[model samples]
Target: MSKLERNEILLLFDVDGTLTFPRTVIKPEFEEFFYSKVQPRATIGIVGGSDLEKMFEQLNGKKILEKFDFIFPENGLVQIEAGKEVGKQSIQEHLGEKTLQRFINYVLKYLSELELPIKRGTFLEFRNGMMNICPIGRQCTREERNMFAEYDNQHGVRKAMINALTREFADVDLTYSIGGQISFDVFPHGWDKTYCLRHIEKFHNFEEIHFFGDKTEPGGNDYEIFVDPRTIEHKVETPDDTRRILTELLGL
Candidate 1:
């Protein structure tokens, strides 16, 4: 297809599990295939819950901005197009200091009281549009992360925490989403992955918008956009699944 023809269809992907293993850099071979084979077929973009710096570290460092047509970091609260930031939002500004402090204090107290298989530091991470809450902590090693994932799968630890948060902050307009293996995110009601759709719509009238993500189930980070009417959702279990689906769907 010609460049213009290809640009008419936008292929949006999630970063962590959809494009790369969580908290790791992209594989060299997959990166080659994605840029050479996949990029030639459609206008590609990435919408990740991570901040831009983390996305860059996992995707391809700072050069990632130039490689993708659109980059929606922090669930599109920070929008970058053509390697330039076009829009941005702040959660601290939206939720006043009093409310933010109350939420933070409650979370810290909850974490301190809860027991886990193992715990580490940096349990709560503040971001541009959300806070990432980690039960075992984000500083865990890869083996620790995988172990926690397995344990949480059986115990539903993250789910339980999210439920508690929902109940405690019932009056607050906050959304809790489980993403990756270790943590969940807390943001304003509409600041999920679907938030990127608005920014994408402003740029072009694409014939189709395809979103590929691993965490597409209810309460997962990808749930909103995956189920949205504006997107053709492909739920993948890993980066390899994402590649296979892309090749089969687009004939790449």
Candidate 2:
């Protein structure tokens, strides 16, 4: 494909699988490409459901994190700079504390009801604007993660969770989607990742913006932006795929 025309473009990425392996550091070559190629050509930002701490785990270091012009953590609920928080918005603030707490309680109960074969610690994680619910828990080791992943593939546990929550919270006006491979992200209606567009437009100017993500299916976290008309979107499969896409997109 011909290189995208050079211009003031905003290249936004999803961190977990798009930028690096889930819960892992960026590949060395991918890191080199970001610094030597991508960053110099276009404004870059990371808009992800993971909190800043987890995002840093994937980036590997503060120096690597600093390369992006913006980092929209917790699904664009906050923007950070130089290890300082510059802006923040909380979905629980809008949803009401009582309601959010109730939702959490319901999720916990639902997971217990499933009575799956394996369970790890820290099943649900609350972030600024969203919460990640994992049936198998977030603290699973790589081997355990793979085991649950196989079971989930066959049982569609994540999808079942999504459906259960959607129906249970139908009257509450919320959104739910499978995030990455193991969990579902639940937030107030309209708080999907596309929420970043409003903040980005308000703070910066660009002729065109591009988004790359691994999960762009109908019920995936990146689906909202993938379908949005305001931004051009690219779908990638893995970190290596991301590197190849960026290399070609940036003409590296």
Candidate 3:
């Protein structure tokens, strides 16, 4: 970890488990800290796998977002500043729409073959810059989400799906990670969370950049960013853990 100096550090945060529980709103205490400590002391940015719409929901709408210096949505495929879109990169730009469509169809077909025991709704979610596929479907309730999540951990269902996808689409350039309770973030190679740094650097400078994320372990979405030399990464288990760490970092 690098020495902390006010105004000399950029703090990047992952949304799901770092700022809030997956698909949940940010806790009020942490939101207060963000407004009090982080926003005033450091360059604030959020790098997340979810789309801007989801980010807004997790953050409890646009009020919290306006406090940040920058925002990276869809794993940094889109960048925003002051509530306005600044820049964007699309997965279709790297892989043609036909190719992406093919991959989506292929995964859907694979899911059909599995015939998993769950009420399904919209197995494949296309986010323009990335895809999040949930075998149990995206429309699941919180309890149903938990049910599938438990089953997935026990069955290695996502791992099997990933293995099949790699073998069948060997010619395609793609990257994916198990995101949240029951979904996969599928995008072009190197479009992981680390992709945001290059864009954020063009606007701000920091001697030491720190990142907070839950999935910093191997084969996880935050792994690439955690391992990057440019960031001093901390693996947090939940949003409260993130808040606790931040409190220490800020010496509060």
Candidate number of the best lDDT? 1
Worst 10 contiguous positions by lDDT, candidate 3:
1-10
Query: Looking at model 2, which ten-residue stretch has the lowest summed lDDT?
Result: 1-10
Write candidate 2's Cα lDDT for 1-252 as tens digits: 344444478889999889888767888888887778888788788999888887877897676456777788877888764456778888778889898888989988988888777998899988878888999998888888888888998999998888878888888978887776677888887888888888878877778898999889998889998889988889988878878887787767
Alpha carbon lDDT of each predicted model: 0.91, 0.82, 0.84
The residue ranges of model 1 lying beyond 4 angstroms of the native Cα positions read 1-4
lDDT of 1 by residue, 1-252 (tens): 233478688999999888998889999999998999988888899999988889878987888878899999999999999999999989999998999999999999999999998998899999999999999998999999999999999999999999999999999989999999999999999999988898888868998899999898898899999999999889998889998998888777
Mind giving the per-residue lDDT tens digits that candidate 3 earns over 1-252? Answer: 355666688889999899998889998888887888778877788989888888888998887467887788988989887678888887777788799779878987888888666866888877767888888888989999998889989998888898888898888988778878888888888888888888868877788889999988876889999999999988999988988888888766
Q: Which stretches of candidate 2 lie over 4 Å from their true place?
A: 1-7, 81-84
Q: What is the lDDT of candidate 1?
A: 0.91
- TM-score of every model? 0.96, 0.93, 0.95
- After superposition on all CA atoms, how large is the RMSD of candidate 2? 2.1
Superior by TM-score: candidate 1 or candidate 3: 1
Candidates 2 and 3 compared: the better one by lDDT is: 3
Looking at model 1, how many pairs of residues clash? 0
